[model samples]
Target: MLFTQAVRQFLEHLQAVDRSKETVKGYKAELGYFNHYLSVKHNGPVYLEDIQLEDMEAYMQHLKERKKSTATRNRVVYVLRSFYGYAVKRELCKKNHAELLEPVAIIQKERDFITEEELEILISHIHQPVIRTVIQTMFYTGGRITEMKNLKIKDVDLENEVIHIIEGKGKKNRDIPIGKTLHPILTNYFENIRDHENIETDYFFAIPKSGSISANYVNRLLKEAVDELGWNKHITAHVLRHSFGTNLLDKGASLVSIQKLLGHANLTVTSRYLHQDKDKLAEAVNLL
Candidate 1:
């Protein structure tokens, strides 16, 4: 089978298994670059069996030459591995060339987070009710943007004060408690802002006549608010999420509780938000 054809099959399988649209779109884009590279190198449609490990290695070099970040290059390579694994399973290819492609080491950086004061200021500047509610939800729930986008109106339980995160990352479902601050905001959005009756979609943040809003749409809304405040901080949805975890820690929420709330697979990932105030850390130590 042609490389492109195999990719099509793999993407179709992803959709058949109920993968999110964004996930399918991401795989298509990353695999498109590899297909383009193979087409240029071989000067025609490349077959799945004809792909060699060296060709994939060369593509890694190509990405490096273009100054792709370590994380991006690693993600592309990971996608290629997923693609070839599917191809091998389908018997379209005899060998999975991508299996040998090594991932680049990533240097972890300190995550950026918005302080409660900064977040308050940022929220004050967002004029759109939908955008404001979305931003608040991220901070309140510690949900990934994809999880937030996938949220349906039925997922929220106003009476019970919990938001059911269905099929989050790694196909995990968890519930986030609706806090006092966030509870009222969500109530206002549902009652006054969200036109669910006319929108014709179950998604909580659905665009009128459309489906769930794009991640880029949420990013652009955050960027506009940041720019208006003349803040130099690079705030994104993930930043708001980090802010949520960090703020919860500041307020004495335990790591285990946070792990469950954020739907983290492990406590180690949730522990990255351990940057407590210096004075507080010292006080804890002095208590001994």
Candidate 2:
């Protein structure tokens, strides 16, 4: 089978299995770049069997020479591994060249997060009620941006004050409690905006007469608000989630609880939010 043909079949399989649109789009982009590289190098189409382990390693070197970040390079490796894994399973290829591909070492960088005060300032600058509500929902729930974007109205139980996050990262579903502060915000949004806006879609957040709001739209709103405030902080919808987890930890929330709330697959993933300041570190030692 042709390399491109195998990629198409693998991507189609992702969609057929109910993978998120973002997942499918990401896979398509990564594989498309790989296909372009193969075609350019061979001066024509390449077959699945023609690919070797060296070809995969050479692509990683190419990404390095192109100055791609370690994280980006790792993502490409993951995509290739998934794509070729599918190919081998379907008998399209004899060897899984991507299986042996190694990701570059990634330096763990501290993620940026806002304090509750900063979050308030950021939200205050966003004047649109719809956008304000969306930002609040993101922070309060600590959900991934895509999960928030794809949230369905049916999953939100306002009366019970529980937001059911169905199929979050790793295909895991979890529930987040509606806090006292966010309860009123959500209630007002539902009654004043979502309910009366004539938004005829299953999505919780939507533009009137249009469908669900795009993730980029939310990020753009965040960027504009940060610019208006003249804050040097690089904020995004995901940062609100990071802030949520960080603030919870500052308030003495346990890692296990935060993991469940954030729908993290493990405590290790959730533990990254444990940012300790100098004062906190000093106090910890003094406690002994």
Best by TM-score: 2
Q: Residue 232 deviation, candidate 1, in Å? A: 1.8
lDDT of 1 by residue, 1-288 (tens): 788898999999999998877789999999998899999999999988888999999999999999999999999988999998888898888898898999999987767688878888998988867878899999888989988888998999999999999988877899999999999999999999988777888888876646567778788988998999888888999899888988889898889998898888889888865456678889999999
Candidate 2: stretches off by over 4 Å: 16-18, 195-197
Question: Which 10 consecutive positions of candidate 1 have the poorest summed lDDT?
Answer: 206-215
**Total backbone clashes of candidate 2, pairs 3 or more residues apart or in separate chains:** 0
lDDT per residue as tens, model 2, 12-108: 9999998877789999999889889989998999998998888889889999999999999999989988888888889998788888888889988
How far is 198's C-alpha from truth in model 2 (Å)?
Answer: 3.2
Clashing pairs in 2: none
Q: What TM-score fits each model?
A: 0.89, 0.92
Q: Weakest 10 consecutive residues, lDDT, candidate 2?
A: 272-281
Q: Which stretches of candidate 1 lie over 4 Å from their true place?
A: 16-18, 196-198, 207-212, 273-288
